[model samples]
Target chain A: MNKTTNQDPVVVRNPTPSWRAILLCVLASMGSAAWAGTPLRVCYVDDRSGVAADTGIQSFNGFQIAVSEINDAGGINGQKVEVVSYDGKTDPQLTATFASRCAEDDGALAIVGGNPSAPAAAMIPVASEYEIPYLMLSAGTDNLTDMPAPFHFRVGPRNAQDAAAIAELIARQGFKRVALINNSLPFGTDSAHATEAALKTSGVPVVIQQTYDINATDLSPQIGRLRSANPDVIVVFPYAADGARVLRTLQQQGISLPRIVARSALLNTLRELAGDASDGVLVPNTVDMQRPDVKKFFDSYKTRFGEAQPTMYPVLGYDAAKMFLQAIADPAVQKALAADELADARVAIRDALIRNGNYQGLQGHAGATYQFGPDRHHGPPDQNWFVFVQVADKGKHLVAADLATFKPGS
Target chain B: MKSLNTARSMLAGPALILLVGALVPLLLTSGFHLRLVTIICIYTILCTGFNLLYGYAGQISMGQQGFFALGAYAFTLLMSAGNWSFWSALPAALLICAGVALLIGIPLLRLRSHYLAMATLCFGLVFAGIASRWIEFTGGTAGMMVPSVKFSGHIVSRTELYYAILLIMVLVLVMQNFIVSTHMGRALMSLRGDETAAQSLGVNVTAWKLRIFILSSVLAGLAGIASAVVNRQVNPSFSEFPILVSILTIAVVGGLGTRYGALLGACVVVIAPQGLAAFGESETIIYGVCLLLFLMFMPHGLSGLIPKLFGRIRRKAASPAPGVVKAGEIKP
Candidate 1:
C-alpha cells in the first residue's frame, strides 16, 4: 500500500542567467547581502556540459530548486541566496579556475561542487587556500575528506562507506566466496580497493579481483575470468553505463552469479540499459525511494526538471545545499551577515559548518545523521548512509534487502 | 636598417602584450584573476611550443599533452612524495620530458603526416591511461595536490609566482624569435615548405626533426609545471585527448606560421571562455560560435592578420589622395 500526500510539485519560472545581477529591494525582514549590501553569494561549480553532464545538470537543478524554494519562503534568516554557477565542462583545470573565481571574484560565502573526485581534487586546494567551506554533492574518494581539511565536507557516502556496506551485506548473505571487479575510474578504483580491503578484514576470501578499463566493449574476458574463479557473488564498482555493459556481458556469457554494485549503478540509466539483466543486481544506495520526503523531492525535481526519472545526484545536491543553508542560518553567521562583514561572514560560515553536529539530511538512509567537526570532516562518513537495494523487474521495482537476514540466493 | 625595422616589427606585438601582462597583477589583485592570467601564460608557452612543432615545423604530433602530464606528475611527485626542492624538481621534470621525447622522436620522426599524428596520439592516450592506472604515483583520476613552492627558504607568494610565470612567458617569446632568426630557423622554414628541397640542401631531416621535437616537448613540460603550480594540483585530465584537441585548436587559431601566433591564440583560447562564463549553459555554444567565426573569416589566424591590417591602415592614412589632407593632417 502506497501512502500519498498532497504537497505540490516545484514550480519553475523563466530561465534567468545567474551571473552577477544587482540585488533588488528586499523587505527589511529578509536579510540583505553581506559586505556589499548585495544578495548573499554562493558559487555552484558544477560539471554541467561534459561527459558527466547528466549528473551535473541534475545536481544543479536540485541545488537551484532548493535556492528557489528557500527564496519562495523567505530566504535564510531573510537574506536571499544567490548561486553564481559555472559549467566546469568536466575539466579539472577549468574547475580549479572556476573555484578560484568563486572565491575571489564572486565573493561567495560558501562554495559547493565536485561529484567525481577529479574536480573535487582540484577544488580541495582552492578551498583550503581561500578558506572557503566546500561541500561535495557526491564523491566516493576517501582522501577528499582527509583530516586537517577543515573546510572540506561531503554529503554522500565515502568509498569506505560503500565498500563497508556492501562487504557487510555480502558477509551477511553468507556467501563463502566473493569476486570484486571495478572499472578504472577514481570512484571505481578507490571503491574496489576499499571493498577488497573490507572483505579481507572481515575474513571473507575474495576469489578473484579484476579491474576493467572504462568503456571497454567486450567484458566477456573479465566475465570469463570471473566465472573461472567461480565466485558465488560478484561485487562491481562502476558507473551506470558501464555497469549495464557488465550486466550485458555477463548475460551474454550466461553467468548468473548474483552481483552487488556501488551507488553509481543505481543511476536511472542502469535500469534502462540493464533491463532484465538488472533483476537481482544489488546496489549500495544512498537514498531510499519509499521515503515521503524523497517522494516530495522527486516530485519537485520532476516539476522543475521536466523528467520523472532522475538519478541519486539531485538528492545529493539537495541535502548538501540544505546543510549549507542550515549552517548559514546559525545566529553567529546571521550576525556577520547583518553587520555586512563579508570576510567575517565567510569565516563564520566555515566555523559554523565544522561545528555541525547531527545534521539529518535527505541523502542518507533512515536515521543517518552527520556530525561534522574537526575529526569527522566527511559530512556523514558512517556506513549507515548507504542501504542495500536489489534491482527487481529491470529497475522498475526495488526489493530492499534486510542486512540482518539477507539470504544468499534470494 | 631594413633588417632592424623587421626585427622591431617582430618585437612590437609581443613587447606590448608582455608590458600589459606584467601590469595585470597590479591592476587586478584578485586570486581568481591572477590564476586565470597564469593559465593564459602557461597556454602561451604550450601554444608556442606546439606552434614550433606543428605550425612551423609541419609536424602534427599530438604528443605534447603526454609530455605535459609527465612533467606535472614528475615534478609533483618529486616535491610532495620525494621531498625534493623546487629548484631541483623543475629541471628534473623538464629533463625527463626531453629525454622521453628524444627516445620517441627517433622512430616517430620517420613516419610522415597522419601516421605520425596517429602514433603520437596513441602515445598521449597511453600516457593518460598509465597516469590513471598507476594510481600510486599519479593518484589515478583524482589527481595529486602540489605543495606550495618554496625556493631556498622563502615561500613564493601568488603575486611572485605570477610575475615569475610572466617572465617565463616573455622568455619563451624571445626564444621563439631567437629560433626564427637563427640559420636553423631558415632550415626549419625550408623543411616546412619542402622537406625534399631541404634534404637536397643538406639539412639532416631526421636529426633536425628530432631536435625540434625534443625542444617542443621541453617547452610543453615547462608549461605543464607552470600549470601544476598555478592550479596547485595535477590530474590525468591534463593528458586527456581533449586537452590535445584544445592545444591544437589554440595553435591553428593563432595561425600556424606567424611570429606571435601563440600569444594571440593563448589569449583567445584561455580568456574568451572565462568572459562567457556569465552566460551559464550557453557559454559553450557562444564559445563554439566565436571559434567558428574565427575559422570562417580569419583563415590567416589572428597573429598573421592583425599586422597586415594595421599596415594597410597606416599606408592609406599616409597616402591620402595627392592633395587632400586626412583627419589630423595639416595642409600648407
Candidate 2:
C-alpha cells in the first residue's frame, strides 16, 4: 500500500465552481490581454535616482498621473494610452537601455522627456532610428531647438528665446551694465550666451562674466571679484542647490545690486529651499501664479497632494503627457503603427502641436499655443515670460512685468 | 564521510538552479525581457572579471570602470569619428584596452591593499575627468556617438545585441571555469590562502598574480566594448562607480575562493537592487542593510552557507551508514 504524503495531490470531493470565482478568473484573463484597439504605448524616461532624482522624478510622476487620468476619462479615441517608465539615473547608458526597450519591445508610439540634457542628447539618435515622436520636456539647449530633428518637439522655451524675452523686458527697464555668473554645465553656458545676445540687443553692457562648477562650495571669491565689476544688475545661472549656495554667499558678503536674477534653476524646490534669500529675486518663469489656468492647476495640486502648488517641472510633465496623448488621439495613429513608420506619427503630432499654437500649458497657460512647421519644432513663439516676482509672507508674487519689459543690465 | 555527503548536496542544488536558468530564456518570448537578461549577463561578465582579481587574488582594483570607459570610448570614437568598421574598431579597442592594462599594471601591481585600491580609484576619477575635459576627442561631457555594431551586413538591434552578449558571456564563463579548475587555479587559491606558504610550494607567485591581473583587466575592457556596442554610446558618466560593483566583490564574501560563489554573489548584488528599485530609491538603504546582515550572519557568504546547510542534512541521512563509503566518495 502507498503511504499518503502531503506532497501528493489528494483528490478532494468538491462541488461545481461558484459563478463569482468563474467571473473573477474571466475578468483577470481579460485584464492581462492587451485590448485589441489599445492606444499606442509611449515611454517617458527620467532620472529616478541620483541628485537629479529630487526634481526629475516629479516630472515622471506628473506625467504618469496625467496619463492615468486621460485613460480614466476614456483614453485617446477609445484606445488606452500606456507608458513604460524607466529610470535614466541621469546616466546616458541607462537612458539608451530604456529607450531601446520602449522602441523594440513596448511598440511605443512616441517617447517623451529630456529633463536633463546629457541623457536626452544620447536619446536623439535612438528616436531618429525608431522614427518615434520624441518630445523634449525640459532640455532648453538652443542646439536642439536651432536645428530641429524630424520628429523632435519642445514644450518649453529655448535658452536664447527665453533670454531674448528677458532682453526685451530689460531693454524697457533701461539698465546698461550687467554681470553674469554661470555654471560650467552646457545648460549654463548656453544660458550665458543667450543672455549676452539679449543684453547686446537691448544695449546693456556686460561688465564681467564668471563661471564655476555646479559643485563648488565657495562663491565668496567669485562674488567678491564680480562685485568689483560694480554692475547695475547681476544674472546668476545655476541649479537650485548651487544657486542657493550662491545666494547665501552673496547675502553674507553684504553686496547688494539694483537687481538679482537667474535662469530656470531658480524655480521649484530650489525656490523653496532658498527660503528668505528667494525673496526679491527675479527669475525667468512662464508660470504666472495669477493666471486662471495656472491658479486652477495650483489649487488642484494642493488639494490632491497637499502642496502649495506644482513647480515648472510637474507642470511641464503634465503638459508632456497631454501633448503625447493629443497625438495618439489623431485618427491616422493607433496601437499598431509599424515601428519603421513610427516617426510619421511623431511628425504628425508635432505638426498638430505647433499649429495648435497658443494653447495654454499648466505654467505658461495664457502664452501663445505651440506652433510647428517644416522649419520649426520649438514650442509657441520666441517671447519672454520672465516675470520679476517678490517672495513674501504670502507667497511668490509678480512685482514687475516680464523681464523682457526691462532694459538689460538692470 | 560527512564532508563527502555535504559536497554532493552542495553540487546538486546549484546544478539544478543553473539548469533552470539555461532553459528559461528559451521559453520566454518577450524580446524586452530577454534584452534585460542580456544586460544582466554583460554585468555578470564584468563582475566575474572583478571577482577573479579581487576575490581569488586578494587585489582591489577600482579602475575596472576606467578600463570599461576606455573600451567603449575607444571603440565608439573610432567607429563614429574615424568612420572605421565595427569589426576593425572592436579589435583596435581590445588591443588598446590590453595595452592600458599592461602599462597600468607595472606600477599599480607593486602596491598592496588600500594603496592599490586608492590608486585604481584615482585612475577612474582621472579617466572620467579626461573624458569630460578632452572635448575634441572624447565628446567632452556630452558623450560620443556609437555607430551601430554590424555583423555581416545587418545593423545589430537590441534583439541581436542580446544574443551576441549571451554568446560572448557563455564563452567567457566556460573559459574562466576551465582556467579555475586547472593546476593554475590551485596555485592562485594557494596564494590567496597563504602567499609565503604558496611561494614555499614553488608556485611562482608573482607571475601568476600578474597573469590573472592582466586577464581580469582585459575581460573588463572587453565587457566595456560589448556594453558600448549594445548601448550605442559612451560618456564620462559611465566611469562613476556604482555601489553595486563594490559589493560585487562580495562574490568572494561567499565564494571568495570558488567561482560559483562569485556568480551567486554578483546576482544578489546586481539583481536585488534592480528589483528593489521598483519599491523606491530607498532600495540603496535596503542593499546596505542586506550587506550588513550577510556580513553578520553568513560571514563566509551564500557560498559557505550552502555546504553547511547540506552538511547538516547529510549528517542526519547518513547516521546509519557511518562506516559505509558513499558511492561518489574516492579514497583520498
RMSDs, each prediction? Answer: 6.1, 8.9
Which CAPRI quality tier does the interface of model 1 achieve? acceptable
Q: Model 2, DockQ value?
A: 0.21
C-alpha lDDT (0 to 100) for residue B178 of candidate 1: 71
Candidate 1 regions off by >4 Å?
A: A1-35, A307-311, A392-410, B151-153, B311-332
DockQ of each: 0.33, 0.21
lDDT score for residue A8 of model 1: 30
Q: DockQ of candidate 1?
A: 0.33
Worst 10 residues of 2 chain B by lDDT: B270-279
lDDT of 2 by residue, A1-410 (tens): 11222221211111111112112333222222132343456777777675567557667656765776776677666656656666667766557656755665456667788777677766776776666677777766555554536666777666676677666655667667788888876567667778898888778889999988889989888999988988777788788788877777777887656455554544555666666665567666656677777677666556555564335667777787887776566655543243335556666665565555455566554654565556777774664344445444322443433345334433
TM-score of chain A of each: 0.86, 0.80
